[model samples]
Target: MKTAINTAVKTRTLPLAIADFKQITKAGLAFSVVFSSIAGYLLGADQIDLTVLLLLSVGGYFMVGASNAFNQVIEKDLDALMKRTRKRPVPSGRMSVPTALTIASVFTVLGVVTLYVVNPKTAMFGAISIFMYVCMYTPLKTRTPLAVFVGAFPGAIPFMLGWVAATNDFGIEPGTLFMIQFFWQFPHFWAIGWMLDDDYKRAGFKMLPTDKKDTATIIQIIMYTFWMILASVFPVTGLTGTLTLSVPAAVIVFILGLGMLLFAFKLYNNRSNRSARQLMLASVSYITLMQIVYVVDKFL
Candidate 1:
């Protein structure tokens, strides 16, 4: 009986540890960082180095994971009140605050060190992204709606971080990548805010537009959507120096942007949960498809 009990405890504790890691790291966010890093590598590298690619991937994941872990540490109390986040490890008492902090710090140091091994610029930007995300944006979430904009700064860094990792420099290529993602976040996050406005309010998170459903908020979403579309197509115009896309690739990109715009407009007109959800889905699809298109176009 003692051995059986010990075995059961081990099994349960192991799963819980894994769960805590996932929750703290925010796996979806880590995936995005990895994808953007890969896309950046494809775009920036003249000749791909598989080894550097591997390092960038691992470093990007670690950096994003660290940011997420720190975010949870900072928001543990707020998370406990939100229905959506109540079951998270930090909020659910599955992990202690100090333990979470230690994990976050270790992951952050490891991530930065890994990136520094690739290049100093990559490491610097990675560190900056995490600092802005956890220190500036997370706290701003409760203070003002402008937190979304601040959050976008860090949110958009992963895509550009990839470029820096490949080239060891910051230039127009990374800047364009950053701009595209930077503009994309407004619509993407606002759509999410729209969908979860009620829950956000309950959790005292000012995620929506000015904490109310108003014309200004919708207009801002529309404006950002327009900018996102424009940014998405800019590379095809040969304006971003060597980052230009072929005509066919440009056309495909435009079509993708149009699809996303249509969904954004739908959300604007309806402003319902269904519309917002559709917009969120469209935004996600748009980013993923655009990344794929950019990489494929670069090769072809």
Candidate 2:
């Protein structure tokens, strides 16, 4: 399977390098990252500065794109072995290694500088996210099953970066935001790993906690989903500075978490890719909805 995928990638032709560059950055995925950052910022800001929010969106998106590009460049060979990634810019020869590097460098500088203008802490966190993503998470994908765990750090950063940008401090509020996202990533990534287990195996990737859709992995997913729900409700306790949810909003958050857990339980019973796919979709909805809920709760 891997050989066939590699052969296809080797012989592929490009229609346009520019289009491929977009794929290189995984722009579609970056949208969520930017949105999470914006949502975080909105939740933290007393009075929104349009300029700071705009900068955070632009800088956060580009930094995420740069990280994706670097990951593709480094994993071009391994990526070619996976059907899902075989046609990616670097693997399919649509973009050269040097070209990809140049793109990454430009995005990094622009993203970091723009974010720094918002505040030093914001830029500093941005740099740390990119570094961990490109330097740490990217390489660990094939080395150990724990890569998903490492990747969660960078993935969760956007949720708290906005608070840091607004106050120029990493306090309990941002930490609560970070903790919420940190726990949320487990079931999210595990569902994806379960759904793509075969494709990933072709590329020598082992990102799933159990590396297979087994009983133990299902149990872990359920536990993480529960933990995520618990973390999401912490704001209701008023222990986190400037982070509080009213009883009604807390109920809504609980409902969203339960919605995700229902699908997770479905995966547990079926132990199939279909179940995993549904869980993945539920996870997406949960993240987006919960953010909206949190931000809306703040205003109310």
lDDT for each residue of candidate 1 in 1-300, tens digit (9 for 90 to 100)? 999999999999998898779888988879887998899888999999998999899888889989988889888888888888999999999899999998899989999999999999999999999999999999999999999999999899988888888899898889999999999999999999988888898878998766886667778888898898889888877778778788888788889888988887787788788988998999899999999999998888
Residues forming the 10-long window of minimal summed lDDT in candidate 2: 10-19
lDDT of 2 by residue, 1-300 (tens): 999988777667344555686798888889999899988999889889999999999999889989998888999999999999999888988789999999898999999999999999999999999999999999899899899899999999999998888889998999999989999999999999998999999999997897777999999999999999999998999898788898899999999999999999999899899999999999999999999999998897
Q: Can you list the residue pairs that collide in candidate 2?
A: none
- Worst 10 contiguous positions by lDDT, candidate 1: 208-217
Stretches off by above 4 angstroms in model 2 are: 1-18
Question: Residue 114 deviation, candidate 1, in Å?
Answer: 0.4
Task: Point to the candidate with the largest lDDT.
Answer: 2
lDDT of 2 at 276: 96
Cα error of candidate 2 at position 155, Å: 0.5
Error of 2 at 2 (Å): 41
Error of 2 at 28 (Å): 1.2
CA shift of 132, model 1, Å: 0.6
